[model samples]
Target: MAGHDLGFQVVYRGETLEYYRPGGWVFFQRPKDCGGGYWLGRTYDGVFMIEYERPVSLSDGMDFLASMKKVEAKSEEFDPNYSLF
Candidate 1:
């Protein structure tokens, strides 16, 4: 971790870089030592503001995730005679 200037080094999911672009969000996964692996995530709404900040912690990460909307995928209806074409 020497010479690493990042606030917190994240494993960087494939989509993590998306946040650099407009209309994208990013999430960072904590190391095992950081409370058995939890996620520290944030959505980039492209807005700037000033507010309080604190050192990242597992409990805080879980609380943040809890406030964010959960993602769910929709499944297609099952069909006995569905065509592959």
Candidate 2:
């Protein structure tokens, strides 16, 4: 698992899987497999996009995502809008 400042990003290639967790909301892209390549991205507005030439297993994708390390903010700078109440 990896750590970032936002939320979590999970990556799976071949038999290896990696996980990343940041402090913000978690987001993910649909998995894809093709003879050439695939592309996926999340927009700043929270829109997720996935383009693939072949189908991918949903179970594998979810498993990879679920393995993301849980990360919590250690400082107030992580969330300026946080309320103590």
lDDT winner: 1
TM-score of each: 0.25, 0.24
Per model, state how many residue pairs clash: 0, 2
- What value of lDDT does candidate 1 attain over all alpha carbons? 0.37
Instruction: Write one digit per residue (lDDT tens) for candidate 1, span 1-85.
Output: 1102322223333433332323222335444565444343333466422111433444464455344434212244467898999
Deviation from native of the Cα of residue 31 in model 2, angstroms: 12
Which 10-residue span in candidate 2 carries the lowest summed lDDT?
16-25
| Winning candidate number (TM-score) | 1
Q: Encode model 2's per-residue lDDT on 2-68: one tens digit a residue.
A: 3234243433344322332223322333344443222222233433344222433444434443453
Over 4 Å off, model 1:
1-19, 43-85
